[model samples]
Target: MIEVTEKAATELKTLLEQEGKPELALRIFVAGVACSGVQYGLALDDEVKEDDVTMESNGIKLVMAKDIERSFSEGSIDYIEDENGKGFLIRNPSAGGGCGTCGGCH
Candidate 1:
C-alpha cells in the first residue's frame, strides 16, 4: 500500500470540493514513460478496476493499479504550493535518475 501525506490529503479534499467530485476516489498509477522511466498519474475515479489495490485513509479512498503497486510500495504522495504553483508531487523510490522532464521520456 502507498502512503498519502497530510498535505496531499488536504489538497485532494480541496480539489474534490472544487471539482464537485467527492464520490471519486483518488487513483494513482505509474505509466511507462517519464525521464525516470516511469511517471505517476492521479485522477478522481469512481470505479476500481479488477487489477487495482484499494485502500482508505484520512477519509479518502485511494486506488493504485496492480501493475504499479510494486513500484509505489515505498513512496509518498505530497501536495506542494510554492512560487512555482500547486499540484501533486510523487516521491517515488523506484524511479531512475532524472527530473522526469528529460527528452525521450515520451
Candidate 2:
C-alpha cells in the first residue's frame, strides 16, 4: 500500500484545479535507474490500464504499474519545503538508496 501526506494532497488538488483536470489521477512509476537507486516519475493521468494498481490516500487517487508496485509497496509520498525549494518525495526503505532522495545523486 502507498501513502500520501496531507501537504502533497493539497498541492496536487491545487495543481489540478489550476490545470482544470481535477478528474485526473496521479500516476507514479519507475522513471529510471540512477546511481543512488531506482527513480520514480509522477504525472496526472486519466487512464488506468489493467496492468496498473490503484489506491487512494488523503482523498487523492493514485495509480502505479502493477509490475513495479513491489518497489514501493509500503512507501509514503510527502511534500518537502526548505531553502533548496519544495516538491513531492517518495520514501521506501526497500528502494535501497543512500538518502532516499530524488535530487542530484552525485
Clash pairs detected, candidate 2: none
Q: What is the number of backbone collisions in each predicted candidate, taken in the order shown?
A: 0, 0
Among these predicted structures, which one has the highest lDDT? 2
RMSD of each: 3.6, 3.7
Which parts of model 1 are misplaced by more than 4 Å? 98-106
lDDT of each: 0.80, 0.87
User: Which lDDT value does model 2 have at 76?
Assistant: 87
* Shift in Å, residue 70, candidate 2: 1.6
How many residue-pair clashes does candidate 1 contain?
A: 0
What's the true lDDT of residue 7 in model 2? 95
What's model 1's TM-score? 0.80
**What's the distance in Å from true for residue 42, model 2?**
0.8
Q: Residue by residue across 1-106, what tens digits does model 2's lDDT show?
A: 8888999999999999999999999999888887677888898999999899999999899999987787788888898999999999988778765554766654
